[model samples]
Target: MAKVQFNDVSFSYGDKKIIQNLSLEVNDGEIMGVIGPSGCGKTTLIRLLCGFIKPETGSIFIGETCVFDAKKRINIPPERRNIGVVFQDYAVWPHLTVLENVKYPLKKKRMDKKQMQEIAMNALKQVQMETYANHLPSQLSGGQQQRVAIARALVSSKELIVLDEPITNLDLKLRQEMLKEIREIQKTIGTTIVYISHDQEASLELCDRLAIMDQQGNIRQLGNDYDIVMKPKDRYIFEFVGISNFVDVVAKEDGVYINAQNGLVKLDDKSVLENPTKAYQLAFRPMDAVFDNESPIKGKVVTETFLGNITNYFIQLGDKQIRLQQSALDVMKYGKAKEGQEVGLKFVRKFYYEKEEA
Candidate 1:
């Protein structure tokens, strides 16, 4: 029920800077996802928000409480922050039963045994684990253990719930089920959840808003799923979200001049043409590109993988490889493409990225 805010936060380990001056806000009852590659500052940010690591030069606010303030030299302890954290490894005590694990957090309060048991059972049922209340952690499966962990967090009724790669260890089927379950639980209880993961696709699908962080701990982009996937702002982001084919071309007054094509390809967004002298990288999604029989652009299919509904083709044109994902039905209409087959490719939608200065 609380909004989390980080204002100009910066954190470092010894002399190595992990998180730079970053500011982000998660609205009350919102599920915000934090995604990045390995070694990025995703976990560090969680630690800072939980009050385990204090920012060197900023303030963090959880609802009305100023949990951390560098200038004022104030740092609130984790227990007082009223935040629940579900670690990547479901941190359940092997000796404790499902009910005991959920009731452990409530033991800190002076609630009677009967009341605690009722609350704990309710939390377990929330996660559909009430039937296994007497089962120890060692007897339960990984997914069951995860359910116990979530129930433990829910029993506290904290303001913010941070799930660090909660479904990473689960199988594909179990992951999907857990994803839906987590969303349902959050919506049912109206608790603000922050999902942290390295998988861009899962984060994009699960979160209302996303924050993409880089290896250097910089926030590369922040937006909804469509914006981040379709129109990436940077080269790093373009390659991270999905497969994209890049073509090098020079910008002109009228359009982008493709040296290989020896013709101008008109772009919808003319902003990249501002720097007429420099070359820009034009990117388009594989699914957006279509194979045309008459188009001059040609490539040899180096590899093709059948994935039931869609077939992914890796075509080599000169030295560059362009990936195209064609629907199985479309392939049937056109004709199943084989390796070493010469195909004409044309992009229906494209985006441009400015060349980075060396």
Candidate 2:
């Protein structure tokens, strides 16, 4: 496996700069995901790394080879970069059979049938689509077709594989299954993978590390799932990761505190308050807002959803609404909650941030 590094890379169409001064590395044998909102340059970053687009400034290195370096006038073509890319479209040949599609890249290397078939079949069996090897891509379902595309991308002995929203079009169940398969395959192949997606849930679950970008082409935060979730670099990342419990916290000389709606007192660690607030948005996951039947921080049970394993509570707290995630067993113990039933709430966890400046 080879490490892929971007050093202060920047690119744009004409005058519109899509990526600027961006630099990051995908370590060998690790899966790193690039996640952001639509039009936040996720795809552009991938293209740049794949050598589809050259950086207008700085360099991109695959292992020690400088694929793109403006200063040195070094630029390598995509086909010569030794990186396999599976784009959003699957990019499979409609007229080609599954096995043929997988064999396409190997043919460029002049590999024989036995050699090519062995690689293709192994890839197909990994995706559980080996039986459909002789069928064309059009004859397979979307998920199966994608598996073929994945197999084709892997047919070559490349050190890095970059996938752009590999499971975007699949249904929920298949999406979940594909994520597992992709992560497993990356491990089995021992190839570094850079996956790009806008889905935070998917990115968090599948990636070893992740980079969250913003509209201005800034790489906002880059780290493992836990670090990003527990200590987000900013409000954009905090909210994007789906931990939406923002309380109006004020830092005083003593401790950080928030008087949530209905007199719910939220106290932060004194250590966080010792320094002036670095962030304006004090956030926490909805799951952290623990509920009890015997506390003073009271709120009405506005709604509840039974989701088999986990029952979600939609509580109305003064002027603000908050969500609580609890087990179905807890819901069974509490009985069916009536709308407007006064319930006790307390802040069990919190993350503080300084206010955003417009």
Candidate 3:
């Protein structure tokens, strides 16, 4: 499989720039997921790689082949690039049967019927839809149709597959199933798949590496799921990823000054206060919030959700809602802490984000 690289890639519509001089590499055989808010240029990035829109002032390369280099004014046609793309809508032709849809790629080449069927059947079975070869796209369910689309893409033996929001339209169960199948197929083929999505859960489960594209069209951070979730680079990331707990505190030279009911209790973590925006919000997962018996700071448990092995509790800690997720076995109680109970609150490992802009 070939590695995809964007060298100082920039794209614009007339005067306004959608993507700046952003550059990154999708390692060979790695499923690099592109995630960000809507209109953050995720789709635009795909178009550039697919050779739909040539970079305005940079180059895009597929394993050393400069497909688009604005300096040289090179523009390769989309069809000639030989990149496989599976869009969100499951683009299967309604007029064709499942076998015809999967075998369409081989039709262009002079492959014999047996060879074509071999490729199509192997791909179909890989997606677990070989029995539906005679079925039309309309007859199959949405998930099944998407599998057909995947099979069609695989039948060509293309190394790089660009999937743009491939699972957004499916129901919950099917979405999960299709995600599993897609990951398996990618692993089985060892193809470099660029899976694009706005959802974090999907990206966390599928991608080996993730690039978070933010507004103003910049790749803010790129790393593993742990970096994206636990150590967000900024406040925009804390909100984008749906993190549960947030504490707005000011940095006093000594420590973080969080306003408590009795007074502003300073929880010392001097190392994290080194940044210029030291007056930051600590964004932690609900699971990170702890209930300590000896702690002086307290919060009333506003609500509780008993989820078998773990329980989720939302505590009213001063003016903010500090959601806590803990293992059911760790706690002795199941019911909500009585109103105004003042359950002791302790800050566990907190996620530090640049303070929110007023």
The model with the greatest lDDT is 1
- How good is model 3 by TM-score? 0.92
Candidate 2: C-alpha lDDT = 0.79
lDDT of every predicted structure (CA atoms)? 0.82, 0.79, 0.80
Q: Against the true structure, whose TM-score is highest?
A: 3
What are the models' TM-scores?
Answer: 0.90, 0.89, 0.92
Write candidate 2's Cα lDDT for 264-313 as tens digits.
35453554543564544457786677666665667778888878887677
Ranking by TM-score: 3, 1, 2
Please list all clashing residue pairs in model 1, or write none if there are none: none
Clashes of 1: 0
Between candidates 1 and 2, the one scoring higher on lDDT is 1
- What order do candidates take by lDDT, descending? 1, 3, 2
